[model samples]
Target chain A: MAHEVTVLTAGELRGLVQLDLAAVDVVERAFAALASGTVVMPPILSMAIPEANGEVDVKTAYIPGFDGFAIKVSPGFFDNPKLGLPSLNGLMILFSARTGLVEALLLDNGYLTDVRTAAAGAVAARHLAPAKVETATVIGTGIQARLQIEAAHLVRPFSRVLVWGRDMAKAEACAADIAERLKITAEAVADPARAVAQSQLVVTTTPAEHPVFKAEWLHPGLHITAMGSDQAGKNEIEPAALVAADLYVCDRVSQCEALGELRSAIAAGLWQGGTPPELGEIVTGRHPGRCSDDEITICDLTGTGAQDTAIATSTIAAARKAGAGSTILT
Target chain B: MAHEVTVLTAGELRGLVQLDLAAVDVVERAFAALASGTVVMPPILSMAIPEANGEVDVKTAYIPGFDGFAIKVSPGFFDNPKLGLPSLNGLMILFSARTGLVEALLLDNGYLTDVRTAAAGAVAARHLAPAKVETATVIGTGIQARLQIEAAHLVRPFSRVLVWGRDMAKAEACAADIAERLKITAEAVADPARAVAQSQLVVTTTPAEHPVFKAEWLHPGLHITAMGSDQAGKNEIEPAALVAADLYVCDRVSQCEALGELRSAIAAGLWQGGTPPELGEIVTGRHPGRCSDDEITICDLTGTGAQDTAIATSTIAAARKAGAGSTILT
Candidate 1:
């Protein structure tokens, strides 16, 4: 039987979907599905090409009740920047959950991943951040830095934004981009500790090998979403920071233990608390997320296949509604 | 940077590549690369959708010298036949190993997979089968059953073939097809034990939950390639069969332990040998294969990501040479 596969380019996807409340809601629903205990998400299939300084990760999940599931291939070549190319780019293929047939090919070039990842930050902040936030800070000066602030602003309505990175120029550029795009007060802070001290919500988006945010900087009424540590050896928050937080939550405990900030804490013997509650549990009201306004909470975002499936499904639906993308019969 | 992705439909792919000597050589090179100890092939990422009685597996590998690698998504919906659809259908994505950019999309609907799997059987037969074989038997009436006979014929030049399956009618049909295609005498045998006893080479290609071939059927100078046990709980050969064989090899030992006939042997405590030599080792001359024509041999093939990568890379090259795909810029 011939099957029609809709092929959407990055430009088409960007025009169809954005890091908005709807996207955040889609990701939040995915978290709820994860909490429902029926989603089948396998461990990531990762391959490292050291010669090219590149790594590719394949992630997929089957979410019940969804019409389709997505298999996302994300490739990151750190040395690509030297060749005047972006460090990250990849695609997603959505297949029919009922028939296991290819339904669409999304050549988002990492745009959907960026949106879903930032939306996850938004979900974490929506449940854990202070009720009212005046300032927000994002560590790292990548595309995620700008998107993270925009996503957090959707829920927190922060008036000011601070961007911190090792490269001051890149940080300034990221802050400028966020300020112009969101029409909010944004500045690049020289010291990460100072940025964390002044903000009610902090989102770390770096792929740093060492902690970029310190535990001594932890303050009351602060909510931190550490999303940089998706791979082992990539740490953005100090191990002690998780211990100092009033409550530590993660997208998935098992994933976080191996690939997130939890990995660092466990290796340092600082995480005596057994298996912290997942972000999904808090989203489902199974666990109270933030007890009081003074509570300092941290949510580790190692990323999940559920989010990829969710965003891909939502994007395909939106594209169908918009009559976007070219269809090829195979 | 803009990139062009070549998309090849199943018909296009079939036109460009075939299960010939070149294809077998490509797979053989992949096995040799596997033995080189430099290939990076991660564990398969599999998800089961029980509601649809379906499962999807994602596999990939990075061979150092290959210009590109493949990430294959294979979906098997067992109930699809009831819906007038094939049980297996999926695609492969070839990406540039250097820059991490997608180069081609192969919508072969599992044709490439079938060819590679059958070619692996030929690889085993080439190194381990008796010096000359007049009769070969395939113990399942599926597509692989026919292809395995064709593949083994490339190595052993078998003049006669036997088809055995639980369903006599289907086995007769498979035998007729093989006879017409290979121009060899083919007959459907009702008894599997009798078929194995008469054949010099036997290939099991069924998704049976229990042993379909028994250890009691083992005979000197006979070689068996069991390719159906690629999933846990799926066994084609009995546990004692490995112990009865003078030499037992596998595509990959760790995979065989988890998802092949070796798993059953280890569970039954019938296999005392620790880590048998891989087929790749024999291909690379690292292990002596087939000490004598009278030595019974068994090769458990659970499949590997390296074969997928090798076939994808070769297919893309062939497609490019033939100019047989649609190129879309993204």
Candidate 2:
């Protein structure tokens, strides 16, 4: 019972993995599996620690034909910034589906989560966004904003990138970082509306309590991927913009209805009483995605345990083949 | 951060831990924390695999003022024995409460679960059972049957032990093992009623879907600890027997009402309409346990997350102090 369990730290994971379009394909397949009703994804177990302004969520999914399942414990302590600590950190425990034994522990400190989230955004953009883009805008200076732009590049190559944040200095720094990382002309933009109107693609990656941009900022043929509204009361897209969109898709309709931008739209009395097709349906050829360039398309990604499992499974496999992680008996 | 986490395997844990009366006291403190509204125990996340006749449950509790919290993944594959594997297997992942970091991994393979369960049974008996006992009966020749009898020895010094099982060979073997282990005059008995009539205490531990003993088999001063019905449909004590008992309690009143002996009684329309005081209440001095020797007492144990957290925290502390287990960066 004291068999070796592979242990991959965040730095080790970051060194060994570069999640790009190919990783998006992995997430797409996971979405298809979830849509096929062959995966067992339990409702998240969430606990709140109001005293510390923190919460932890446990998510996992057992795919019918997969070799491993992942149980991810993601914690967010909103007050950690003042203490010189990252607000988000957690680990994933991967188990063998056959024997239910611990296969690996990914103490990635949310590195894998960022990778999967970015990959999921790329997958959605690939299936739903416009084919060509001269300009793109990212509404946040956080880690996800940079990752989303990188992920969005896998779907649509953009020349000029507009970065926005509450703090203009951080926004300028993020723009410099984006320009260096993606090798593009990136600039900090204070006007969210102007940035939105100039770009064909918009990715909002903020923990905003209100809409990131006004609904009127949406332009023709624009596709948006809102990736920040995974929790209740978090909104990165206006409700009116969602109603105005021609095709609305989400990572998981149930999750969206409960904790995503869809929940906000529903709360605003703007959403129609019909379930939109999930992103998986489009990926699996069950529904048409991005019918016309003029059609306003949006994909609400509230995240899924399937993506977590998919990424964890692939990470462990890659780490083992590369001999990138240490092993210890537990 | 690649901090070290103590890893405790099943064999190592078994060698170091003896969960008897003292362990019961540990569990009692956890129950007190739970009852005092200081522990954050979330609803269990459960998933089922119909094809494998299996289910996995993730349970956790964050006790206030504790150093760490434990998330336990308990999976039961009913068809495992066909492949030379036990039906239940899983591990606990303990996280530091302050930083939400990995503290330890207890790969106990259900050893800790079994220990906590036996300790709970002992706690119940210590508070509710008759003080003096010449004989005690245990139904079912499973691992729990052995553990429960050993656990019961902490509260009452029985001179003789009776073991009953459906299979005569297993029953006789279990009795012989008990005699050798506990050094009591033990014998296998086919007649559960006859065994109940002679013994002052009864501990039922089986995966029985039906009642093990009838209500008519009960005698005055008989105290029973039922430890089998943890699922919704499994019962080892008759509803009538529960109704006839003078005092009744369970590890958790809510859990008992949903999946323990109390559920069976309520289904049969025999339970009185009120929440029976929990064992925690009695342990916390809020409720009187056994008042008279002639009054029959019964306690049902459906298990709790608090006990898991307590045991895991204590185990990790001990392992660190004893320099046991392998440490891995997570």
Candidate 3:
């Protein structure tokens, strides 16, 4: 019988060791596959579930490049502390369309979501930011903000890291945690502007409805990676910051127009012709990255299915090699 | 530190030892969840990849009820013989949207797909078909045909099964397999008309462009379940057969109108109703199933996200309790 199955549970998946570098590398290869036209990735379909307090957002995306989908299902700002968990929790699935087989299962518990987001930052830094970049500033102290810092460190080799959050204690704790875990010098900055001005590379990760980072503090040689503002109503950076950038890159044009930082930029009359190329175009070598060292660059990642596919594929392979799960036949 | 991920692979999932009955029970529970409105299901998106010979079809469904999406990515027919494997192979991912965590990874290759489909049939049979129905006539000798038989047997005590296919040997082989597997007496019939004429319940599972069974062969006290023809340019039962059906049900009106057997029926100016009630409505008692035992009943399954959500949730729970897979946090 051809009807055999393998089953993997969330608890089992959560028990394994983390492979950060491997995840990044897998994302890199996924981009390659995406550019090779082997993958078909569609933008995620998101719907809002209204509750008594706030609403939950459900989004699903399919990446043909890696033959799977990374579906994000999470509640947003329920405001009930007793829930005692992050609003987002879901898994990634790697399915082989060739045989109509699901190849892998990942119980990320939003961890891989952060990993993929971080990996995207790493990719952006690898292609768009200068090598051996020293100082970095991270705005926002949420999970994404933390991941962006780690991902930027992976690619740019930063010696010092600075974080700014609305809560001073949270920011201080975040900086301390990073310093202890990643072994990088990290400190909390009181002013978001000061954090922006202090570093050559700035990473913004927040859920602000308005632009938290202004344009005036941006430097000429700075490379800014915007990881927040994935939702339609959210944005982290001012439109003028993008206007000042020498080069701009977007994960998906349609998505960026609807949700990413590019939405505001376009709303402010940023012409399409003058806009930066898509990330896939850059990955495919159809365009160059960071034309000049002094040129300000911005890479807007609202996230894409290609990255999910890549990460899911890699995770499944690694998990399989480690002897995970059980098999049953129907 | 909290943002670590664990991964599970296909091989590891293969080590899972749960049987189909357990999966069936889980899927059944999911259906109840769906009927209760506790499940949220998203739309299905399909991308077609056309090659030199045939094309690959990728279908992605977001099951909110189960808090994850079950994605089916399978290749075109051309890849089957060349690869020495079935054209359909893929895994199901059960993600918990509550915490943004993937709860289970099911690698049934497409076995779970059939299980879910069959479970849906059982769900339909539970609500729609006559309770004491016995004999069932199954057209087409594919995986779904066997599943329909099994699912029908589970719901009702079907002592006799009539199998019909284009190839007599294949049909006979299917009968032998069903007899051995389900412990029900089955016979391969050469004439499609004879099979349908002799049974109280009928199911069609084929990739035929035109319907094979005729309207005159169908009896008054009968129930027909059409599982094939999920895309355009595909169908099985004749339009006349639908005209002869007293009560009609479908998974989704939009999907059935575009791709299922309803497409042809709609084209031929069949019933005046805009769309049939969803199977969930019937199961939930919002809509009536069969009015009378003598009334001809039809349930057209184009598939739905709720079913995916249900099956995925169950698969994860079983995998977890069985202690399946090794985890790698990335």
Would you list the C-alpha lDDT of every candidate in the order shown?
Answer: 0.93, 0.85, 0.69
Highest-scoring model, DockQ:
1
Q: Taking chain A of candidate 2, what TM-score results? A: 0.97
Chain A alone, TM-score for each of the models?
A: 0.98, 0.97, 0.90
lDDT of 2 by residue, A5-65 (tens): 7888788988776777768888888999988978888788888766677788888988888
Q: Rank order by DockQ, top first?
A: 1, 2, 3
Location of the lowest summed lDDT over 10 successive residues in candidate 2 chain A: A1-10
- Collision pairs in model 1: none
Q: Which parts of model 1 are misplaced by more than 4 Å?
A: none
The recovered share of true contacts, given per candidate in order, is: 0.81, 0.40, 0.17
Question: Who is ahead in TM-score, 2 or 3?
Answer: 2
Highest-lDDT candidate: 1
TM-score of each: 0.99, 0.94, 0.76
Off by over 4 Å in 2: A1-4, B267-272
**RMSD (Å) of each candidate, 1 decimal:** 1.0, 2.3, 5.8
Docking class of 2: medium
TM-score of 3: 0.76
Q: What interface RMSD does every candidate have?
A: 0.8, 2.1, 6.0
